[model samples]
Target chain A: MADIQLERVRKMFGKVLAVADVSLHIKEGEFMVLLGPSGCGKTTLLRCLAGLERVDGGQVIIGGDDVTDHPPGKRGIGMVFQSYAVFPHMTVFDNIAFGLQMQRVSSAEIQRRVGEGAELLQIQQLLARYPAQLSGGQRQRVAVARAIVMRPRVLLMDEPLSNLDALLRLQMRGELKRLHHEVRSTTVYVTHDQVEALSLGDRIAVMKDGTIVQLDIPDRVYDLPATRFVGSFIGSPPMNFLEGTIRSSNGARALETAGVRLEFHGVPARGRDAVLIGIRPEHIAVERVAVAGGIPAGAIPAAVVVVEPIGPQKLLTVQVGPSTLKVTTPVDFAVDQGQRVWLRFDPSRIRLMDPQTGDAIAS
Target chain B: MTVAEQRLEQTLPPVRRQAVDWLPYVLLLPTVVFLAVFFVYPMLQAFVLSFRSPEGAITLRYFQAMLKDTYFAGALRNSFLLTAIIIPLQVVLALVIALLINTRFQGHPWFLFICAIPLGISDLGAGLIWSSFFTERGYLNLILQNLGLINEPITFLSFERPAWLYGAIVATEVWRATAIVMVILVAGLQLIPKDYFETADVFGASSWRKLRYVTLPLLRPALQTALIIRTILAFQLFATVIVMAGRIVPVLAGEAYFQYGLLRNVNIASAYAVLIMTLSMTITIFYLWLLRTKEEELGRG
Candidate 1:
């Protein structure tokens, strides 16, 4: 296993800069995932690291050696494509042993390594079958086994599980995690699936427009997103944004928004007039309002517009002033449409974002 | 048959079942009638004529006379040699051209158009076009003389130089027919998904290794098709040989044409036709056996 260092890597497709000048360092044996939406250059960056795409203006170093000019085969990296790309003409055994044969390993060694890799992927019975005979999940396993049997210094996967069914994808995801733990190869996985990134990556690099927006652990990426794009892209229902302004009155600053005044001590709101308050769905506390009962202090009044059952939780679409918010509640929390409710925003969970730049305001 | 198919057969009414049985044959009537009239009947007539004399005794006299002819051995030898040489040459040239066109570079369509120009020309036209280059006062000799390589024009298609005549004929045949093979191969190349090449690259396969393992194996069906077509066409090489080399090369088709058109012997012509047809069918079967598809082999396995 070896660490990968990409220094100012840039790739251009004609006039479009697919991957701009970006620098990243992946530690040895770390599962670093590049997470982004489609066409955000996550796959391009992975391709550049794998030496499949040549960098226009930077160096890619693997195991402390500059491999910028090296071919994919010479870069000591094994890649699994989205389409699996297992050779259709060769049997599963030959597909796994292809790189080994190319490296001139002895037949006995090739057989042993192929057997070992097949056992690792639990595809021992499929060794004699062609790619056509295997299912989509089986082909995915063959693709993984083919790459891992090479024992490359760095393993690159470009959404390897996206082709499988949902249940199979989950199963393969667990298998990939277990395989990574067993081999401990430095891996760079590119995917748009935030769940995969959150579950599999040791550190996730959320990218947008050819640049990494935020690089952190999964929890921090989910809870403390650095930008609005990160906040919106990381979650399914996504973070809700409420327009607000930071105002100082009598030597104290507070965010005024939606007919409510919320105060936080640590928000560095100097010289920022327009601010956007971001809160995740599960952070809001919803309480039903009874007739002739007074609303609680520091609670924003709202009406539940829609209730969507999602497994054990119900996602409630609530109307708060002119804005809408999605809140997740337990399945047993019975609430009807158009019912008046009091919503309390978790102050610590609230993120102050700059409206103009779409960046989170440090607090 | 499966139980479902058997059950379906039992469930069908007798009237509809009889209609279904006749439907396929009714659909096939036109093609069968067409083949019998234009193909099978003529083939049978020719076979009978080759075996029997004009008196219709059904003796081997025509075959004996055809075998005793001076050009028989030379015609058979020339036909086999041309097919042996031209099929491989055309296949290789066409494979290279197909691969080049498959790259789809800038102006590649124009390149393919230029390469495929000869496909639009008839065999006689192609032969004449090349003859203009190889004739004594042709462009080739003129260019050579102007370049000061030769003091005098060289005789390329005369009886004195059978090798030069043969080479010129081979060149014409290869140039004229390689396009069809290339078109077939290009279609074949298009059917191959690009992922296999990418996988090969990731596995450290060179261009040669990729062709040897990935491309050639996958391209067997197309290669077989091209080889069979080119071999069958080569056995019938007549107009080009006649226009280029004249009496110098004795191919089967040229011999048949000579006996029919010049000597007015339909029996000898039919015999030559039968010989050429036999050779073509034999070689086509050989190519089909040699390049049987993976699906067929796998089905048997």
Candidate 2:
């Protein structure tokens, strides 16, 4: 296995920059996920790493070699495409054996390795079947088997699970994680689905407009996003942003927005008049009745606008004055639309973001 | 199916089975009538004319006479030789042209347009155009002499050089017909998804390997079609051979034309027509057998 280093790799399609000057170093045997929405250059970056797209500027060093000018075949990488791309003309056995055949491996060795890979993927029974006879999930497994059988230095996957149905995708995702744990090969997976990224990647690099905005472990990416965009893009129901003005009085700093005032601590909102308070849906606790004291110290009274049941949890869209906020509650919680509730924000979990630049304010 | 649906189906009569069957036949009636009057009738008449004696008794006199003719063996040999040389050469050239166009480089549309120009020209027109260059004291000789490659002008279509006459006819046929095959192959290439090539590249396949293992295998149906069409057309090669070589290269179709037009013998001409038709059908069957697609092979298995 080999680590990959991309140094200021830039690619352009006409005048539009598909991949900007993005530099990232993936450790040997680490599974790195390039996560972003469509047109965000994550796929382009993966293509550059695969040597499929030539970088207009900078270097791509794999292992210890500066292989910036190498063709895809010579780069020692195996890629699983988004469409699975299992060669329809060949049987599953041939598809898995293609790379080995291209490498001119010995017949006996090819057979042994193909058998090992098929057994690993649980596709031994499908060796004689063509791609037309395989279902989408089966095709995906065949594609994975095809790539991993090569035993390449780097394995690149471009949204390989996007085409499968939800249940199949989940099952395949677990199988992929188990496979990676067993093989420990350096893999670069590109996908727009955050759930896949969060579950599969050792480190998720959130990209936007051809440049990576944040690179960190999944937990860090979820707990503390680097920017407002990252914070909003990562969580389900997303993070609720409330426009509030920072007020400093008598050595205590507090954020006052609408008629609700929540005091903040350890938040350095220096030189900013207003800040965007970001809070995840699950972090806020809602009280149906007023507390003994009018409201808790950091509680904001709000009326629920909509209640959506999501399996075991209830997502309540509560309006705090003119601004709307999504609050996650237990499914058994008795709360309805038009019901007034007091929202208690976990003070430590509150994030302050810069409205001007969409950057998260340092706490 | 659900029990209710099965019960409904059992309770109801099959819907309009006769009318649906009769509708398709009624729609096909015009085409069947047209073929009967224009194709089957003439084919039967020709078969009768070729075999029957003048006294209304069945005889093989016309076939025996045609076989005994001095030019018949030479014509048959020339026809087989020309077809064997032309079909393979045209297919290879057409595949190359189709692949070049598939690259989609700048001005490829214009390149395809230029390559297809000969397709618009009739076989006779192409023959005439090339014959002008192959003639004695023609542009070919002039250019050779001007370049000092030859001191004397060559008579390319001379009867003494049957090989030269054969070469000229082969060149004319190749130029006139390769475009149609290229068009068919190009359409077939487009139907193949680009992902296969990309996957091949990722798997470390070289350009030649990609062509052999992927492009060619996937292109079987189109290749089968092109070979059959080109082979059938090669057997019927007439106007171009007549235009380029005249009597110097005696092909089967040329013999038929000579027998019917110059000698005023319709029976011998009918024999030649039947021979040409048999040859075309036989070659078509051979191609169909040789290039059976993977699906067809699998189905047979």
Candidate 3:
């Protein structure tokens, strides 16, 4: 319900700067996810936004007013912690009613809000039950209900699904997305899980080293990663990097590295001694070659080291000289360990990356 | 029993089953025997001594003699007053110290060590240490004189000023025993997950609100434990009273000692001991009921 902005916020934990100079803008009622690996400062950023942590320098504006100097309660923010943080001593109803009571709402209004929260999270039957009686998923739902019952101007969730089992986590992910849609409260969700960020966020801010390395819609972030780190980081079995340099042979541009050559066109050749050829496993197509046929152009011949079956997709570990590439194919791809296959790299799909900056070289 | 447990019982061999049933009692024998010898026997002896006359017949003569003794009323009043004042004082003081330590303030381990150093000192040793601070020629008087706050040293331990003697003794007892309560409460504070407090903070609960709504509720068990033990110890105030207030204060334990050591009457001493024991047990039960943790609360959490 409020627009939250951070103007070059910086936070220091003793001598180590945890959240370096960073600025961000979250639109009203937007589900903006801060995603990164553990200790990537995503949680720290969320805490600063929630007013649970004070930024050492910079202004925090919430709903057109400065909230940096205000306490967490005055910030009009609600948070669901990773641990669920449901009050063990209180029943589900009491937990949800706590904030309303703190605000001195009437008993009738408290009941109405708590009932609505329970209904929203589908925890009405659990109203009288203690946290000890609830499952991990149930407790997390209670945590969500407790946060949203008071209708805080902004809601913050820190890896709320991380503590649940795999099946429950997936289920809760969908539930969280649905809840956000229903409430439409401006939310800042933090997680290390890429899939959660991609599926849940209207916009995902991929973070690294206390900075927003990339902020884009899920599709753009996946298809055209701004940095090599973003490209490698966002995928499972991550994006493969073939270390190479740009070769300019008579104005023809090609990247050559470790028994792999990807000849590319359209993008002008920038003279650089070193470049990284980045390709995702799913994007790398496996070509079926006739038993006695020679390898085709734009295809690199490789020997498969390992073929791992995961669900219907088979992950093939192919050896390209000293380097290996993971290629995803169908279950019935008819591939085995040590099988010879040609790896195809569509020039357009391949990302040209600067080795030094770890960023994709702009076309 | 559940159907599985019933089926399991049927499946087990009779010889092994009998052995399994006896295993618990066999494991419990050492503790039961030790308690009976060291605890139950003394209590029985004291009970009998307090209820009987010197004529070797069952009577309430010693109880009557104690009730009629000059120091009995004073001892009862003094003991009651000390416990009444010390229970809340120590609970609050120990809780504050424990919470402060739990914050993990800078140099927290050193601070915790300094706070708990008194736990290592014997009650008698603690009493003696405090005696020096309250004596007429001690550091307190010296400081007052040097600061020009007073022309002469104050007679803090003098019989003329019974209130000062009481203050010195009460302060000594509180200083000596509060550490034990604090150590217990500190452990209790640690048992509470930090996430609850964080949740409170996120919900906009002030620090005081967090303490009331989150901390005190979860700390019920530890508070109960600390209060029960401190109340029991307070009822038997002896060493600190002896060292600090000396004969000026007629506390229950001091009266028991006086009758047995000075009057050479075992019957009267045992009566006083029984009285103190009864009072302590009653208060212990009261504390337990006051802060009882429900069995259901511990189910999964």
TM-score of each candidate's B chain against the true B chain: 0.89, 0.89, 0.90
Question: On residues A216-256, what C-alpha lDDT tens digit does candidate 1 reach at each position?
Answer: 99999999999999999989899999887778888888777
In model 2, what lDDT does residue A344 have?
A: 81
lDDT of 2 at B95: 96
Model 3 TM-score (2 dp): 0.90
Best by TM-score, which number? Answer: 2
| lDDT (10s digit) by residue, model 1, range B186-255 | 9999999887777777778878888988889889889998888888899999999999988779999999
lDDT for each residue of candidate 2 in B101-181, tens digit (9 for 90 to 100): 988989999998988899899999999999999987789999999999999888988888888888888888888999999
- lDDT by residue for model 3 over A1-363, one digit each (tens)? 899998999988988888888899999999999999888899998888878788899989999999998888888999899998888788889998888777778999999999999999999998988888888999999999999997989999999999999999999999999999899999999999999989999999999988999999998898789998898789888888877766667867767665556666634456576877788898888987997777677688789999999997999999877678889999989987878888887777888788888888887
Among all windows of ten consecutive residues in candidate 2 chain A, which has the lowest summed lDDT?
A289-298
Candidate 2 residue runs with Cα over 4 Å from true position = A290-297, B1-66, B296-301
Model 1, position B218, has a per-residue lDDT of 85
| Model 2 agreement with the true structure over A68-131: per-residue lDDT tens digits | 9998888899999998888777899999999999889999999999999999999999998888
Q: Which segments of candidate 1 are over 4 A away from where they belong?
A: A263-266, B1-65, B104-107, B147-149, B296-301
Error of 2 at B32 (Å): 7.3
The lDDT of each candidate is 0.89, 0.90, 0.87
By TM-score, rank the candidates, best first.
Answer: 2, 1, 3
